[model samples]
Target: MSGTGRQLAVTADEVVDAELVDEGAALSPAPADPGATPAVHTDRDRHLSPETVAAIEESVADSTRRAYSADREAFAAWCATEGRVPVPASGETMAEWVGYLTVTPRKRTGKPAGPSTIERAMSAVTSWHEEQGHPKPNMRGARKVLNAYKDRLAEAKAEAARARQATAALPSQIRAMLIGTDRSTLAGMRNAALVLLGFATAARVSELVALDLAAVEETEHGYDVTLYRKKVRKHTTNAILYGTDPATCPVRALRAYLAALEAAGRTEGPLFVRVDRWDRIAPPLTRRNKDTGIVEPIGDPAGRMTAEAAAEVVERLAVAAGLSGDWSGHSLRRGFATAARAAGHDPLEIARAGGWVDGSRVLARYMDDVDRVKNSPLVGIGL
Candidate 1:
């Protein structure tokens, strides 16, 4: 499928004026035979591929995909077992499947299927239907059912949330860890920069990972970085909607990080590159033969710095500070909100700082959870 077309010509000045041309062509493999029709080819089949369906599922967080994938496979298997065509099912079949699922316990969660779970399963199937030229299921009715189920889920989640202890690094812990690190080493400097940037910017893991060297900008207002969050959509011409905040966007730590990167003469490409345990440029490693295998040198690492990696960085820093609990990248973001609230920063200011479209929404969802400082009387203060 890849080739270059070239023409060769020979020229002479005073000799017999003549032209000779030779053309080069690449190997062309034979077209694939259209075998017996596939199990799920509809008029809209051209709009989607098996891989597209897989990618859509994968575009969610990694762990969520695990459950969704299982559900998808189970539904597919049930259809196969019943000798039903694997094409898009009708609304009646879907309703029947939902009914069956309500009674059937989930293989992994080992609980009677809840409405929210069923809704997600239906969404997956619904997406499949649209991809295969069938009409989309009525989401409004599905949402009503989902909302009714969500009430039950909300009660369960409340109990769960109560048990889920708040997880975030204390200011003392973060400060101690940052000061304790030997900033002389590249890794140490990078770690310090990461901690500062991670906490100050309150960025998502994907946003931090997407940063390029050029994205970090220094202006009179302080310093700021441009990050394309995963969930945002691009415009018609594929231009990013660059949301800028003032230098208060943790420009200091980011500037320091950039300085170090510049001193090392790395001024382009991904701002965060991999360094292995041995301090070598971490080569691309793939999960092969039940073991990690390094591939020949490639442009980038084997994969993006996943959320797990971002979480691990926080965990390591937490351990350094002798802290515990589910401290991860998310905690860092939450920490920013908590700390900002504790610092008497305006909720609207914090929202704008975090690059949210609406400050009110962030105030309602994130900042509202900030608890008042405990034991203010324990510390000595001037009367």
Candidate 2:
């Protein structure tokens, strides 16, 4: 029978094999029930070859794989709870699920999923069904349901946009953050360098954490940092020029940070790493003193920083600077565009600087404050 005709079963083995088994594991046998009908195993339950499994897994990025896994689990859980078949979810079932996601508050966040999240969840559900050899659910009803929630979604989005606009750090605020950072400590130096480089490059948090020591090349003018575009997986080079002032210059800050790393004999690996509460870089291994039985960490020169870690650097700096507004990793990128526009740079130039391939509209979104101040007809009008 075609996959679309398959029915969802409640057996543990069936559910596990259909959704959780990604490593080509052999499926468990169905429960013994001589009085009942025999269980039918589709090709989906068969153990895939290791090579085939590897190839399939490698087809998507690791982040995408993780998201898809979470999505599948959520869908499966919902199905089990509702006593509905997940494998062959009908259009009506999907429509109801979409509606539930829209109106329902998630247990963890205590907030309804946004429109983009709902759309992605639907995509994940579709992908999971297709992977399990089931026909994709017709989404016509789901689309209508989504449309019904469109106004609420738009309002939620508008609120979020306003929040972001409020958080866009100005040049003075950026300077405050930089000056407030205590550069003597290891964590402070690293954070200062990170903030400067991030602002100068207009880099995403992912891009900031993805930097490697080897990717930075010294040039006649300043330094050329090679960054791999996360979306396109393409290499792009950005230049960090030396600032006239030694204190606020990104190049100087990075040099001081590198010097500190070198002083600690760290010559290779990730450009940024996690610093512990004691203001020390976390080492790869922990060593115990043979005599005193004191455990000492040997810093890991090759350790990499996560995107969350990068965001913390921003937040901590913001707190130190005594700024009252909300701050996040994207604040630096937004700050860059806003600062550039305030500095009299055009939209296209700001877009190119910030790697905004979408166009001026996106860049303008980041520079809302600047646009409001400069482009408003009421700017110079007498009341």
- Deviation in angstroms for 9 in model 2? 24
lDDT tens string, model 2, 1-383? Answer: 11222211111211334467544334555556779887698776665665566655554555666666676678778989998888789998899889988878888878777666787788878866766567789999999998778776566664422223326665677788888778998888998889889988888888888898999988987899988765444677888999877877888889889999888777888999887788777766678999999987664445678887888888888898789977988889888888888888877776665677654455767667677878899977897
Tell me the spans in candidate 2 whose CA falls farther than 4 Å from its real position: 1-64, 130-136, 150-166, 285-301, 341-353, 356-364, 367-383
What TM-score, to 2 decimals, does candidate 2 have? 0.72
Candidate 1 CA-lDDT value: 0.57
Clashing pairs in 1: 223-247
Position 100, candidate 1: lDDT: 64
Clashes of each: 1, 2
Residue pairs clashing, model 2: 283-299, 283-300
How far does residue 157 in candidate 1 sit from its true spot (Å)? 10
lDDT of 1 by residue, 236-346 (tens): 111111223322224555666678767766788777666567653355764444354643543356333555676677778777777767677777667777777877788
